[model samples]
Target: MKTLWVLVIAWASVAPAASMPVCSGGHRVNCVVDGDTFWWRGKKYRIADIDAPETDASCEAERRLAAEATSKLKDLLANDFAVEPTGRFDRYGRRLVIVKIDNKSVGETLIAAGLARRWQGRKEHWCPAP
Candidate 1:
């Protein structure tokens, strides 16, 4: 029937529009929010598969490491980089992504540098207990 054909066409047109936005090509790094997060083209992104010390750290050692992590991440993002989405989002609504600088994962770089740790479904302390 003509009506059925029209309905089918309308549905098909709307389906693509309703799909989730994909970040494939990547975005320019606008600024680093912290060690594990950054802002890109007005969107907040969290580094995937890694966790860094909180900027508002509780202890002196943690605070120092947090600052170091932030600085290191900033330096990395200063170069040409791309963000590949992990098909996930954090609780804070940040897009989870693996930041690649010169084709190398920034998260892995930070981990190797002792600036961050691999995320294991939970946050761990960056400073040893007293």
Candidate 2:
């Protein structure tokens, strides 16, 4: 019983940051860039599991959906969450991470809500090309 309990506790601490660091020393304020990107303590992180519509969307529908996804992302980040580094970075130089809340993926939440899609090796269009 004791060994089992210890293992459970240890596993829990291995991931989930609990809370991201706040801004200090005059760095940029922490904020979400889009559904799958955010800034924390002056560093940018791209969510590794999903690809959301770009803010500069090509179509009106895409633009609107992008805004909705961005808003949803903002609200989700307001509560307790975790940022688990993926040991990789995007071409734009943003560190990649998997953000989770209580072990549930933030990306999956957005996907369920029709706000985002699973990321493939390359970005898939949010809408048909113009």
Candidate 3:
């Protein structure tokens, strides 16, 4: 009984992040370039804030999981909305954009959904007038 109870508590603690639904980031785009890259309007974009798992891994499970996450993000954004650059250029040279679906900022939406992290470290001015 004691061992079973401990196992249950451990599973409960890790479940939320694992079960978290894959949702769209507020900056909607066309597709993923890699685990960390994406495309929007003939331009390439890297996620401005979060460092997701790298595609390279010794374990196949780790690699597949990262690929799946990127695929899920792209799948959710397909044909769903229009987006504009946020006026910020990330270190990778992709223009940051405020994605809009039905006139909603995709960035805000993604953050709210816990799909993407708020990039408070990035300066707002980096997003150019668009």
Give the TM-score of each candidate. 0.76, 0.78, 0.48
Residue pairs in clash, model 1: none
Write down the lDDT of every candidate, Cα atoms only.
0.76, 0.78, 0.50
Worst 10 residues of 1 by lDDT: 13-22
Q: How accurate is candidate 2 locally (lDDT)?
A: 0.78
Clashes of each: 0, 0, 11
lDDT of 1 by residue, 1-130 (tens): 9999986554321111111222234563366777898777667889988999987788888888888988888777766676777778999999898877666888999999999999999889877888
Q: Rank the candidates by lDDT, best first.
A: 2, 1, 3
Q: Per-residue alpha-carbon lDDT of model 3 for 55-90, expressed as tens digits?
A: 565566546656665665555455355544456787
- Per TM-score, the best of the predicted structures is 2
Off by over 4 Å in 1: 1-29
Candidate 3: segments with Cα more than 4 A from true spot = 1-30, 34-36, 47-69, 122-130
